[model samples]
Target chain A: MDKQEEQFVKAYAPATVANVCCGFDVLGFALDAPGDEVWARKKETPGILISAVTGVEGLSADPTLNVIGVVAQKMLTDLNLEHGLELQLHKGMPVGSGLGSSAASSAAAAFAVNALLGNPFTTQELVVYAMEGERLASGSAHADNVAPSLLGGFVLVRGYDPLDVIPLGVPLDLYASVLYPQIELKTSLSRSILKQEIPLKKGIKQWGNLAGLMAGLLMKDYGLIRRSLHDEIFEPERSVLIPLFKQVKDAALKAGALGCGISGSGPSIFALSPSAEVAHDIKNAMEKVYAGSGIETKSYVSKVPEQGVRLVEQSIYQTV
Target chain B: MDKQEEQFVKAYAPATVANVCCGFDVLGFALDAPGDEVWARKKETPGILISAVTGVEGLSADPTLNVIGVVAQKMLTDLNLEHGLELQLHKGMPVGSGLGSSAASSAAAAFAVNALLGNPFTTQELVVYAMEGERLASGSAHADNVAPSLLGGFVLVRGYDPLDVIPLGVPLDLYASVLYPQIELKTSLSRSILKQEIPLKKGIKQWGNLAGLMAGLLMKDYGLIRRSLHDEIFEPERSVLIPLFKQVKDAALKAGALGCGISGSGPSIFALSPSAEVAHDIKNAMEKVYAGSGIETKSYVSKVPEQGVRLVEQSIYQTV
Candidate 1:
């Protein structure tokens, strides 16, 4: 079938904080600040083509090797679209930063390619295609980052067997204060330090906290969220990789933050605050602690992004 | 202070299905049949007195050792009430059958004593006291059975340190089919076979299913509930202790039951269905499978009880 008209689509997928302390590989939410954008155009040819790539340093231009390229190719193949597509990958966040950099790129590509193909699949299908890209990078088909990055807001990866991702209702006033220290922490290296087996006692605590955290968000109980934002299973073992992790977390709590812990597998750490004002205060407190340790830090304070991946209009050309 | 009234208070606490497949130690729901009833009366004396114990075989009448007595004593000490209370413990369920028999008695005692003292504590506080009773029986402070028994519905044990029990909204049409195999399977013996360490992969699957189950109940998604009811962590090992466990579970599923697995530790097995008719049908299917294995089984089919523990009028004396 010959395509009558060609369409250009630009979409953005927000960065996400996966794991969310006690939730481990189950919970994540999109962030407002850093994200990836993909530009796609319909072509007469029958295969996905990589047109351009920019923003991130030291990345291969090969579509087969790139996150966005890999996700776009999978979507095209799965949908069996008659029209070929070309994609441009643009990264706004640094790679391997624990802030879901690859997920953002994959999500943006999936969202853009779907739009370019007239959105033949549901958002969940798009998430699955994006997860394939995540699998390419992580070697495991985990959806903690990809689901939230594609769906926006807080997403609970209920089960991966059939790929169930449920969006959770979050407190609108709640804010996150994230600090990305100027250091490289590859997810593989961070994951390597983790024990394959978690103590049953700690596992109980982690799941309890996970449930409590969900209840807290749904009921808008800040105190419960604060108390429940503890990770006995993963954080204690993984935080050893980050310098002054305990001090930074303590400073955030001392500074009136509800809770503080590692952001995914990290050199990045985050704290939860009830208000934007408190989130900024918590960011400053975290920065101060990191500054004391002579580690340069970049911080962000934003509410949970309600939209995951969205089409960008020409009017927004000034923004991204 | 002398009591102004010597009023009588009798309450019934429903039996519970704890563990709930993947949510071992953290989730449970009350069943409609086979529960414990406690009769309480205000006394001028300053301590708790156990007047009678019946129904369950081989249980000590000692207040300190018995679950009902232990829970009643804790409630009295916690409240510091001047008036003494006398309790008559009647167990309607079999002991060591893995049907939360002890939890029912403990919950009934807690609910009755609180009513006898004019409701000094909230229902959640009552759950904590009942959990203390469970600790006396299991040597662990687990709220899986006691919380749902006392609260009467699906309960999430979000945390046990300060004892946070959240009552969840359940599907009103959901029905449970439970079968007790008339065999003794002590909770301790069942628990002893479990590995202290679970592979992180299995742990991920377990928590995912737990979150999925909660989402299913909240969203009223039956398929999600069925898919999420799997248990990869505890059931594989514990099921070895129960004869014909696999055949019974498979038969229930074959009869169109949503999901089937061991209810708590075992000797009893349960299957969830979309309706009461299916539940009853599934029960018969399960019974046939057990009968083929030369095992006697008693089956009960009822909706998820919306009420946990409740007061009874004098007209119910014949039932007790």
Candidate 2:
């Protein structure tokens, strides 16, 4: 496709919290309407190439070293497709901030490149490609965030091969509030502070919450979600690193959030509420707690992202 | 009521395994048509007391120290039902040999006692009472095996407070093979070896499997269930004690079992198969491995206990 017909494939992928409280790396849902954007065009050249970056002042446009670049290249390499990508990342979400900002960029780029390459890979194969982005971030391959980002809604990664992804019918009433502090807690560091061997007792506690969370997502049972949101392993260890973790979480509960916890690896907190009314209230409470700590924060009161990364406009000369 | 007019309650409680590999103590399920038996009758003395033990050797009829006795007292105390009881516990299963020997006995006594007391608590509450019994043995409130034994079928313990229990709709094609290898991995000793904290990377993998298992149960999707039946956290650590763990698991997989793992703590292993045909194959393979290990093993091929603890003959009574 030439520049005249060169429509920009601008796709918006949500910022996901990979370890959603009880679920750790295997569970994640997309943020509704609040994600980052990646705009790509098929180049006449034959390899993936990052052309521009914005909002992330520290990032480089080098295609090989960038997280977004690596994901796009892996997808093309695996699919045996030969096409260069001119990717422009509009960093709407933060970097190394634990909202899965990098994954959003990666998902967007992989999704766009695949689209530009005529979309040969299946949705799950795209997820595998997106996981390369996660491997780059933390040196471990995880699908919790990437799977949901690629498939949309709530996805259970049953297995990698034959790729069993079960779609949970999300409750229509769910509203979420995610508060991001100005400080960044790199995924690498947040993960490092965690202990290597969890007590068997704590392991059971975490999975109990995991099973309940899965049920809650399927049944949209808010009460069960609140009861199941307890994370005995990561939160106890990682929360100590996040300022005012207790106060913010208590605020969320007091503000009527069904439950609240540090999102992913901290510096960001998330609350689950049954209504938009409660979601906003929970957001305000988190804001108040962060304010007391002399930290500015960005918060979102949204729903689970239903449509994952999608072309904002046909780029038939477009935007989303 | 005289002996001729006595109200006798008899109940069958299936064997259960707590922790269930990845789930630890928070997840468990009951095996059908094979377990233990409890027979209870109201005492004429107006106080709770145990009177007999028929099967498990070394078990006593004491009302305090006996596993079944303590659990029975707790159940009656909650009901404020002061009635001495004549309890006969028929231990069809082995003691201290995994397969939830202690849990089955406790659940049966509590369940029988509950029936004797007019059934005041819900099934979940009975599990709570049974968990109290486990505390006597392990010194903590754990529910891996007790929940499923009391509630029957597959159980996902979401939380302890208000105890979120989700009953999984198991696949109709599912058949379970419980192999007892004439050995015992004491819950206490097995538990003591676990690390105090787990690595962040591995924790997420466990949660992924947990969610996948739940989804598999709900969807009755066998392939998903097999793929999801993984224990990244506990099994890796605990399986070290169970000799031939990997080879046995591999053989079962090769024999067409959906998934196989260490049942309860150790010395026993269970495999899920699609049919009795596959189950027989699993039995042969498992027996071949453990039999060669210089360890004698027993196996039970069954299905999920469809109806949990229940009255077999409510109004009728027959004893030879």
Candidate 3:
């Protein structure tokens, strides 16, 4: 556990679905699979070095251009640690697919570096560091994705001035089916398309749905959750960017999914179901809509995870 | 209980504080004191009649103009009952005080008439009828006030098209301290001054606070409740209409109140405290702000009530 120990620490961070329908910019939850992994090793040098990047193309090995390097540098600077680190990132999900690709990398890197340094911070304390990576990627530091990827479960980013990230209760029998249409949609472009001003009446309905969703989660009321998973503002405008969005949503609902909506600023669509079987069925139904449309698709059926980034492997005095 | 019985039934409905800061147009909670009462008697005649109206002036006794008569008529027509009714309204609170005065009257009338007709409707089922009275009173059928007044406890109006009124849990020790300034701030005027559209950022914050407040209530987290009781949208525009608004809020917070803000529209201020002693202190502090300012104010310190409109007395075979 010594701070100076020469060791390699590897961690896994899950992909997260942000904005959970009606809870735009405030709510998110982590999925069990399709995550990223980061390996960190304490070095005698005084700066960060990216050893390798794997499982993805067109990514930078330069520390200044990658999310893993950005997150680790921030953590070390904030902790006043002069020790250098070598890091490796392996992307398990598609970048820019709106499944929080950058968030997973940032969370995994923050968690791995923290573990390599003998753990000076709690898991909750790592959120701010991860958000720095999001700022680098999306031009805005939002915690909806990062907090869930770092802390797991459903997280409500109640406020940003003080960064109040609350871990909310989730229903025991909930499952999520996410379908990522293989299309490039920039987060900035998706965000810019949104109306800066929304009708007050629509705002009221959105908040009501958010409250209902929160209550449903705490009480484990599936009917309330289903009723509350509606987005009146974001979906109307953003869904046009994705092909067959309406058709996919309709298929999911018909397959016994509790609710369906775009995930994040999405080319990705997510549906919630009561059980694993329904989630799988929903996934198949969602996929069949895009079959032979000349576009590829990736989908995942996962339970909302209870744990986020964690040290998956550790070896002391390992040579890099 | 028989529908044909010639009986006089009386009901009392507690005053409610709607909006509850960040939950504008969506949330409310009932109070233990300062309410309204209504008496209903089955009549042999074939038309609705208002026998008397007391405790407040400038009110009509006409069946169409009075809220009680309007609500009873709606209930009877909806239930397919040809029976006529005679009603008397007793106002226990000031008119247009922003303490849900009209809602209390509407709720009491609905409860009393339902009882006089042998309880044909459940208390929850009476919210729509009471909302009709609200529409007549404020030109809008908002249920934030009426739901809490009918269902008791903290209530969230999740949606309006379907009229989903969900009763939420209340902390066992929560207390509300309300101060109503005698100055008249019409609900219609206060509502009209609000901007029809709001910035998306502000909307996000408002919903975040609402979610936090809902989580706080369900989990009984006092600190969370205090932190979440903030209004970013309505209070900024509406607080200007109330005299000495900022000073009263400051005094309430300085006196150990958890949170404070304008109640309903304007001219009335409410503060929440953890204990009865602190609530009383907050009430005194709030009242002291208006002392000698030539603005008359009435204050009440009470626990968040568990019961709403209920039958107070039932006399069978009573003459109208």
Candidate 4:
């Protein structure tokens, strides 16, 4: 083994907001804070191992059961690297929070291991390996979350058959506010409630909004973004499951938010604003909706980050 | 009456290609040639009249039956102008060729009359008035054609309730080639064959492509535009109605066209290319498919113009 093999690399992957209102299953962006961290070390052995997991309870340490371990194993197998990997996952975000918790861990682990091996694959090339973790967690291999968590900025999952994930231009002044209710909403149950068939007229309107939102982001038109960030397909059906969804959305909009909608398959809600001050105000307004209602909530205000799955720390250690 | 009322104001409105593959009923762009012209004059009396109709047989000269007359009458009524108007309609493109023939007439009349009345409305304000002519012709008030024909460049009809028409950026090097097969396909028949409900999976894919195409246009990414110019919902059902649709599309792509699809309703195929030379090549290749098949065809190759309707000529004359 090389001298670099004895070093431990810790990487941080940002939490992502998938679906992004009008762009269901197609758009996502990374947040600046509240991300997962993974520490990776390569060994002379030939099997993947999860040394520990922290920051969240009830997570398994088994290499086959953990998301980070599974993603790292896939990367190693795909690259034909016979070296063993040891990982420690620190979850900074709650699971089932609609904040792409699993995607963050997978991206951090894959990025850390790639860094340890001198990055044989580009950051864009690591999206597929990270998607396997989403499939294990949500029973579907979707890149909306994984792509943004790995690539940062705004991402468009243009297609899935050939797996085309495109990184889009991000408006630098845009900010996001997320309010997560401390309740679990199963991704499968949320998905099952959606109608399999939609009216053609509604579908046309949805795509129009998608096109408008994409154009608004590219041109940095705030009014167009506010007008286009609406969901007519998935939000109506899924919002019934979220407590006080309408009230939260209304409060966010009243607090100077550009747009607001359910975050992923939610119990969580997200609102976008033009500035960090407005985003903080939106977060406060959203939190007020759940106040005195016996529901605990966690809120985050952040600027959309430009980088994802970055190496945070690295240290050399002596083997016992 | 004023001295300007005695002069003849002639305006030209360009033909448009609607649907634009993935963006059905929402996207369109203006072409440079094969447009209609309208000559308008205000008299001291208070009723609208169509003085002459030329360049196409079987068009009505009656104010109520002619599209230009109807559009001009509506505009006068809406603006509360109590002046008599005389219009001369000159059709430069074939009717029912899926080249937005009626939309051109409506836009030209609206634009000409607006100019004659001291330019009371902006170009964007004329789209709704132009869409009224579409309703009279096609039984549906769709602005996909008239919006682009009035606003120039590419337009997205984001919504219909309040009528939101947004103009998109067009690449300077983009060229379009259109081949209109001389066949009449009724708009109602073309619309009736479409299914009312579609699978949600197909809808997701369609929106993904729509977002990608909009991004491609705003960023001037030719490869992304080529990849995203696909129609999963409309073209499949509509292409079967057009003769040699598959053969023409295949030939265009093989001849270095970026994308090819049915224009407006049917019988007209449009291809976009990076340069005017490649667009001309695509036009030739598409024309060869129907050369010996006994189908008469009209082909046009032009760069996408930045201006739509404009005053082509003005002449002063005495009231006889």
DockQ scores for all predicted structures: 0.58, 0.50, 0.88, 0.85
Residue A57, candidate 3: C-alpha displacement in angstroms: 0.7
Better of 2 and 4 by TM-score: 4
lDDT per residue, candidate 4, B218-282, as tens digits?
A: 87889988988999988999989988999999999999998999999877999999998899999
Per-residue error for A232 in candidate 1, Å, reads 0.9
Sorting all predicted structures by lDDT, with the top scorer first, yields: 3, 4, 1, 2
Which one wins by DockQ: 3 or 4? 3
Local distance difference test, each candidate: 0.83, 0.76, 0.90, 0.90
- Distance from true position, residue A180, model 1, in Å? 0.6
Q: Which TM-score value belongs to model 2? A: 0.88
Better of 1 and 4 by lDDT: 4
* Candidate 2 vs candidate 3, DockQ winner: 3
Interface RMSD of 1: 1.4
Model 3 DockQ class: high
Ranked by lDDT, the better of candidates 1 and 2 is 1
Report the Cα lDDT for residue A149, model 4.
Answer: 92
Write the residue-wise lDDT of candidate 2 on B209-271 in tens digits: 778877777666787777878887777888888888889999999999888888877768888
In angstroms, the error of model 4 at A164 is: 1.4
Write candidate 3's Cα lDDT for B137-229 as tens digits. 988898999889998889999998798989985655789999999998888889899999999999999999999999889878888888899
Candidate 3, RMSD to the unseen true structure? 2.5
Ranking under DockQ, best-scoring first?
3, 4, 1, 2
Worst 10 residues of 4 chain B by lDDT: B311-320
Looking at candidate 1 chain B, the ten consecutive residues that score lowest on lDDT are B311-320
For candidate 3, list the clashing residue pairs, or say none: none
> Global CA lDDT of candidate 2, please?
0.76
